[model samples]
Target: MGRRPRQGPPRPPAAPADIQLASDPQPDLEHEQTVEAAAYYDVDLTNRLAERVEFFQCRFKKATLAGSHLAKVRFTDCLVETSDLSNLRAEKGTLERVKLSDCRMTGLAWSDGLISDATFTDCKIDLTNWRFARFDVVTFEDCNLSGADFTDADLRGASFTGCDLSGAQFHNAKMAGTRFRTCELEGVGGIANWEGAIVHPDDLLGLSYVLAGALGIVVRETDR
Candidate 1:
């Protein structure tokens, strides 16, 4: 019998219409503050430092969170679009029911974070760090994830589609039920720990070579 096809994660719910528009041009975020049900646009929060902050049912459009350090933060039911989130470090953070689109997120580090029901689309997530993170029902589409590190991460509920995963590291990571489709898999590290992960048939040829290299197997032509 052939292998059974795996299903992708369910899509997250869209934002509610009742969310209020923020009267302020920018949000005044302090440590351990919880901001909810507000819509912000063009807020410049670059290089800000805060801890244990929470955002619920908030929408950020064209906001700049670049180089921010928001440790132990929580984000739920949020939509972030066209944001500059490069080099932002949000270690030990929690993200649930969130979606990010058309964002520049390169060099972002979310180590030891918990992410659930999140989707990232058309984002530049290259060179990011997700070490020791846990993902549940997370999906990435049309994203550039080259050189991202997933060492010791739990990716059971993660799926990638139309993404660039070149030079990504998955060393000692949990890969059960992880799915990849129409994604680049070149030079991906930690092929030895890819048990129970599903990939499209089109990507099998590249993945086979990666597996061979990990096993130290060389393919050579034989004379007839």
Candidate 2:
């Protein structure tokens, strides 16, 4: 006999204060000196060196970090939601098991950085450079990555699902076991430099133009 279909769990009720605005406008960087597992909201941190800073189970919401250098910093079990990390440089920084949701990170460079089990959802990362960075088990879902550069980066087991990669460059990148599923490759360049990238067969449709351009051949349609 066949088994019955399983039912999912019931949904929770919506909160009443979902549309309420703050009265006093939350202060930025209230606990800059203190290092604790707390929520950091509405902060603007720039040109600061945060070394060996461990953010364990902390929340960084709507924060803006510009021109800051973070080295040996670890974001373990932390949530960075709706934050702007533009022009932020991170070298040898580690992001282990961190979640970055709905963040806008333009011009962000993470050279020689290490990212493991990091998840990026609905993030807009334009002009972001990740040269010589090592990424393992990283997932990028529904991210807008226009003009992003990943030159000479090591992307092992990195998955990009439903991401917009228009104008993104991946020159000389070592992408072993990299999966790009349902990604838009309009105007995306540097496909010839992918040494060992493992792309999905269905996603190979996006490389039609790139293959034709590489072989110097024109694809013309024939009408019946």
lDDT of 2 by residue, 1-224 (tens): 12221222211212222222222343333322334456667766666676666666667789777777766566676678999888887766777778888998888887778777788899988888877777777888999888888777776557788998888877777665677888887666677865556676877877778767777877789788
Model 2, runs deviating above 4 Å? 1-34, 219-224
Candidate 2: Cα lDDT at 133: 79
Clash number by candidate, in order: 0, 0
**Alpha carbon lDDT at 112, candidate 2:** 76
Indicate the TM-score of model 1: 0.91
Give TM per candidate. Answer: 0.91, 0.77
| Candidate RMSDs in order | 3.9, 8.7
Over 144-208, each residue of candidate 1 has an lDDT whose tens digit, in order, gives: 99999999998888999999999999999989789999889989998877899989998898888
CA lDDT scores, all candidates in order: 0.89, 0.71
Output the number of the TM-score-best candidate. 1
Which is the leading candidate under lDDT? 1
Pairs of colliding residues, candidate 1: none
